[model samples]
Target chain A: MTNLMRGTELARDIVLRASEKAAGYTERTGRKPCLATVIVGDDPASVTYVRMKQNRSHKAGLESRHVALPEETTTGELVAKIRELSDDPEVHGILLQHPVPRHIDERAAFEAIAPHKDVDGVTMHSFAGMSFGHSEFVSCTPGGIIRLLDAYDVEITGKHAVVIGRSPILGKPAAMLLLARDATVTICHSKTAGLPEIVRTADIVVAAVGKPKFVQGDWIKPGAVVVDAGYNEGNVGDVDFDAVTDALITPVPGGVGPTTIAVLLEQTVDAAWRELDA
Target chain B: MTNLMRGTELARDIVLRASEKAAGYTERTGRKPCLATVIVGDDPASVTYVRMKQNRSHKAGLESRHVALPEETTTGELVAKIRELSDDPEVHGILLQHPVPRHIDERAAFEAIAPHKDVDGVTMHSFAGMSFGHSEFVSCTPGGIIRLLDAYDVEITGKHAVVIGRSPILGKPAAMLLLARDATVTICHSKTAGLPEIVRTADIVVAAVGKPKFVQGDWIKPGAVVVDAGYNEGNVGDVDFDAVTDALITPVPGGVGPTTIAVLLEQTVDAAWRELDA
Candidate 1:
């Protein structure tokens, strides 16, 4: 029997708690917890994603305010809008949809959001804090992955964790969080040589490469807990799910993707509580 | 016959060039390269280290301004003095001697040094920049170690590099630097499990555990390049030099220690040059 690492069920549990907290916060503050989502350009996928997130926030008893920008928006213009939201005490969290126009400096836009309100945790301040094991908002995807691990009661401390892929959002931050937990962390990327040898020794494998089924079953050690954070086109993942016979694995569609939104909402409520307290 | 990595010799070359550049900058700018040395209290080791560094700087034709505070100095007082040096045009670089006092917040003092004058690069700004592959002055000892690696032409790209130890100044920063070079980087600390197995698979091993002969010979893969960055008591190193019969290794007493001073001088000259050019 293939043991599945179920993310959807765990996320449902987290979201239910977040919704309760958000409702309590609204009762105390006399205003709903608010998330400001700023999306630039007219990419269809980005629009759909923003709409979906907004819908989820509403369902969770939190409010999302949308700020739409034209495709020709300049970097300065985008940063200005983000700064306004960052300074607005009424807005508890800020979410800037990715894939801003190629002309704009995306990093600068991300950095404009204040650290306290960066619930999405895309800014360098949050990244640095998380890397150093300090108390700060973690990147949503990695945060969700860690939550899943904790929910499953995976013993991370003193384990050999191999993280494949090095993207700033997923692989790199995930490794940092794991290292902070006392795990011996190894980060592999496109330039990494002897990838299979490294993968074969891991107690935990986090496959985050965007390519479909890039990590084979032979690469996994016996009884290792595998977390596939990849969700590629056609609903495929970075790890070959069918290849691993007895190990615990997270499936593609219901795995990390579903849990990310859960983490995002949870952090939003946290940010709201902090802001209200402050 | 065993191949030994000559870290002292390489460091000497760097120091010579650095001294020459310092001299040139003094001639052009009519001021010597000056490093402000801030010492919180009079710990015997700290006193000796400060004097040794000042003596080296003077021999290299750089001026050393000493600010020795009393043991009762508060964090704010120390920060004020560091800020004075940070704003002083005469000070090209600043080095606050570490291990201030049990009562004082060391990180607060580190953050006081301005990035432009942070020749030692102990600030969070430097660490963040290094992690993101940006051009910033690196932590001195780790920066010097990287220079040693480059001088030896040890291939870093696509290599399985294992780093033991996780101090902010040494192991952690070194791991980030190696990761920046496209190496598959693994960080093992005191809490790491199965360290021997991990080290056995590395193409390149950096031992900075601060324990004498902690890593044995059989743990090294054949033909792997080993860097011993540890300086333990009695002039012994982290790696057991006598254990590895054929691998290239850096000798403890003469290796990474000398390179530390070299990097400090080089960065001081670099800061002076930036001032002169500006």
Candidate 2:
């Protein structure tokens, strides 16, 4: 029987720990940990994501400051807003909702957030830190995937991990994190030929291609641990969930999604503690 | 017949181009391009390395500013000196000789060099840029290796490139550079199990483990392009020079070493043009 890697359960445990930490931090510092969520020209999806993060922050006993900009906001305007929040003493962490505006330079805006308060881990500094294996904050989804793997007692060392896709935040960071853990990591992308053949040799498979059911179940090696980081429309994932019989696999709705928010909250509390201690 | 991938020839070509560029910039701006070299403590090897760089800079028609700090310089003192060079308008590029005193924090020192003046590409910003495929200056050795591969017309796209070792400067950056070129990259380090089996499967193999002759020639796949980035004591490489009958291989003494200095000089010239133009 293939075990379901229940991300919700693991996320719940992480959230509980973060909540306790948040409570203690508030008690000692006389102020709740604050995460400022900045969103520009809010697409419905981005709005929903920001709302979800705010809700989770509240549940973890952290405060949230929402900054919704106009649809026509320029990159400079957005960067200035982010810089303001980055300087604000009340803001312990900053989360810039991605896909801010089509014309806005998102990378520039991400870099505007100070490294200390980059709880979302979107900056180049954060990415380098992750690549070098000493990041204070990891991009949320990748961090969530690592936590999920750990909760399931997966031994990453000496294992061959094949990561699909090479997005800046998700795919690239995930590969680096796995490599830091001593896994022999192979990164395969769209240009990779004989993709399924390569996937068949992986002891651990991570699907972050953003395509719905892109990886067929048979492509996965039997008894391998599979992680689906893609949450497509209509509750589907990049991995064809029903097709593979794996030793462990994360489901679409309840798996990586919940854990991502959990990590965000945890990192927010972590940022607060570091800031206060310093 | 195994073709010797001569770094001397390729490096010579690059140096010639950079020389012409430097001469043109000097003519146009009324000043030669300048590279500031900072060294802490007089490790004989490091002194030799710094002198070699200075000689190469002079030959390339660039000016070199040599700063030799005391052996007892603290990390803060080192950072202060670097920051001064960073702010100097005449200094187009900066190279901090690596392996400073054991007590010094190397990463902190590397971070001190301004990103724009980081011609040696040792900064975290440079590493991130290399990983993201748009670096102004790549770490010298990895950039040299990529140039060597290109000179031989080795196809990187979709090829399996296995990189051994995970040092912050060499192995890790090499893997990132290869990945950026669309190769399927696997990073195998000291803890990697079944190392030979993994090496045997690569279309491109980079031996960087720092162990002399660690990868036997028999471990090489037939017709694979082999790059030995290791230059051990007595001029030996990580790969057994005579053991592998590969399509192309870089020898230790004249292979990676010449190209590294070539890249450093080239980037210094590039930095001069960018700074002067601005």
Model 1 lDDT per residue over A43-127, tens place: 9878987888899899999999999999999999999999999999789899999878999998889989999999988877787
B253: Cα error in model 2, Å: 1.7
Give stretches of model 2 more than 4 Å off.
none
Q: What is the interface RMSD of candidate 1, in Å?
A: 1.0
A148, model 2: CA deviation in Å? 1.1
The best candidate by lDDT is 2
The stretch of ten residues in a row with the least summed lDDT in candidate 1 chain A is A123-132
* Per-residue lDDT of candidate 2, residues B188-258 (tens digit): 99778888988988999998889999999889988989999998889899999888775589988899889
Q: How well docked is model 2, in DockQ terms?
A: 0.82
TM-score of 1: 0.93
Our model 2 lands, by Cα RMSD against the true structure, at 1.3
Candidate 1: residue B254 lDDT (0-100): 81
List candidate 1 segments past 4 Å from native: B272-278
